[model samples]
Target: MSGSHVRLEPLTMDHAAGLLEAGADPGIWAWLSSRQPVELGEAEAIVKAALTDPDRRAWAQIDLASGRFAGTTSYYQIVAKHRILSIGHTWIGAGFQRTALNTEAKFLLLRNAFESWGAQRVAWETDARNLRSQRAIERLGALREGLLRAHRIRPDGTSRDTVLYSMTDAEWPGARARLLARLG
Candidate 1:
């Protein structure tokens, strides 16, 4: 579960404090999947429950430079047989944005998926209106697969069109090189 610039460490009771600290981000929550929790107590429950889910792989994001907990990212919709996976539920404090933190985190995940897990395709989906996220995923060299119209109920309980992006094993070499260049 460890990434290059961050570690996707297994979530545990001991991680409550770090989870709370990471979730303290208020600015980024507006466009994220769920709202940021208000207190350390609330984050603990959320992180704990997210980890207990059988279908998803969740982890804490650790910022290498500050040695501080940054946030959480997970691989959902993992179809091992099909070699497909999705990275979502990701959030980072303003301080960690545009840094090597996210690039390396993604590198690790992609590396593990394509090389370690033998996954053929890695997917990243976001609200179509979230231009920032769309750019970031594209920056990682994912192809603009298409948009899912009214794909899911948003945090505000409204339907949302999801932009789907993906990188396949055939594309991993270029994608990894791009991510590495940024991190370097």
Candidate 2:
């Protein structure tokens, strides 16, 4: 998926070096389920795990201007029969945060899920402690459903409360408009 500021490409081991450089800051991995990759080998392992995950279709987010890997995102827990999917495990470099990159990236993913795949519902889950992520999700026009207590274990081995959000097919039009306006 191509956007003005970002392009989504199927992730591969070739992206390991770029991913490691872009995600150099340990802070970006704080709320993620996985630990920060401290070396090239670790980053390659991360990419390998993503590729082998049966339920996930991962992408390498590329910054168009620099033509470098910015981060990664994915559609996981997909249920084709129910037309449902979750978008998460997304992280962009600090340099790209608070910019059009994230908005456009999300717009592309949501568009593909709802329009191309006929997804009935799209979902997101974030660590409740990560207020920034929660706010970002709200900015995408997803409605907060509820909290899932002790939903998953954090990378640091502590239990985390997950804040759940979703957007339905019926609500996509409005969210789509909102995202476009933000991009413009």
Candidate 3:
């Protein structure tokens, strides 16, 4: 999917080097559920798995001006029959954080999910400790649904409390307007 300053292409093995470059800062992965890849080989493995994941679709975010990889995102826990899906596993390199890159990237994804797919709801959940992510979700006009205590097991074997958020079909009009204003 393409946006003014950012675009998302299918995640592929070819993006390994770009992922490594974008993820150079170790702190980028601090609150992520997946393990941080410390080497190109590890990044390659992760990309390989994402490419073949049956239940999810992954995309590599690209910086339009520089044509560089910025991060990765995915549509996970998809339930087509119910017209629901969760957008998670998103991370942007430190350089792109706080910029409109994230806003537009999200705008594109949400547009696709709701407008194109006719989804009734789109969900997001983040580690309870991730204040940045929490704020971002709220900024996108998603409602704080609730908390799921010990919702997931992290890569390091620790249980994580997840804070849930969502935007329903009824809420999308307002959310879309807000996102578009941010993108502007």
Candidate 4:
């Protein structure tokens, strides 16, 4: 649950307010398909629902040095029997981006799923136009599995292509090691 620079913890009701506060900027969700929370109450409600889901996995990123709420992430296409999961719903506050907070958060999640839960693979998907996210996933050593054109509608009420990336158990150890090295 904890990583070197950040802690990937279960998203609880308590983090609702912090998430809203960190997400106050509407522009933050520009690239994400989800609706931006207009207020704290809305943020709380959405996070509350995500936490209680039986299969959909959600996690909050915590900054180790300051212990502040960094952002949130989740696994949606959960296939427990196949030991496969997908990491999505990811968005780090502007202050947290490009800061290695994301790398550390993912390293912990990948480590947990593959190491702790014996998962065969973990996945990541993003808007195909989101070049930044695409690169970030590649840096973690996730192979470019493929692209789902016209994947889904965005919050702006338009469609977007989805880029899929993944890391298998065999690749996680080395990927994890590289991520850790970047932290130093």
Please list the C-alpha lDDT of all candidates, in the order they appear: 0.83, 0.95, 0.92, 0.86
lDDT for predicted candidate 4 compared with the true structure: 0.86
lDDT of 4 by residue, 1-184 (tens): 8866888888898998889877877767888766788888889877977887787889989988889998998878889889999988889987888898888888778888888889998898888888988999999999999999888989788888899898999998898888878978
Residue 149 lDDT (model 2): 100
TM-scores of all candidate predictions against the true structure = 0.93, 0.99, 0.97, 0.93
Clashes of each: 0, 0, 0, 0
Better of 2 and 3 by lDDT: 2
Q: Could you give candidate 1's per-residue lDDT for residues 1-184 as a string of tens digits?
A: 5555777776676777877776676777877766677877777778777878787888778887677888778899998789899998888877788877887888888998899999999999999999999998988899899999989997789999999999999999988887777877
Q: What is the full ranking by TM-score, best candidate first?
A: 2, 3, 4, 1
Candidate 3, position 108, lDDT: 92
Q: Candidate 2 lDDT, tens digit per residue, 1-184?
A: 9989999999999999998999999899989887888899999999999999999999999999999899999999999999999999999998988889988999999999999999999999999999999999999999999999988988778899999999999999999998998898
CA lDDT, candidate 1, residue 137: 90
> Looking at candidate 2, what is the lDDT of residue 160?
95
lDDT tens digits by residue: candidate 3, 1-184: 9989999999999999999889989899888866788899999988988878888899999999999999999999899999999998899998998888888888899999999999999999999999989999999999999999989988888999999999998999999998888777
Highest-lDDT candidate: 2
Angstrom error of the Cα, residue 10, model 3: value is 0.7
Lowest summed lDDT over 10 consecutive residues: which window, candidate 4? 25-34
With a 3 Å backbone cut-off (N, CA, C), the pairs that clash in candidate 3 are none
Q: In candidate 3, how many Å is residue 178 off?
A: 1.1
lDDT of 1 at 75: 91
> Model 2: residues >4 Å from true position, as ranges?
none
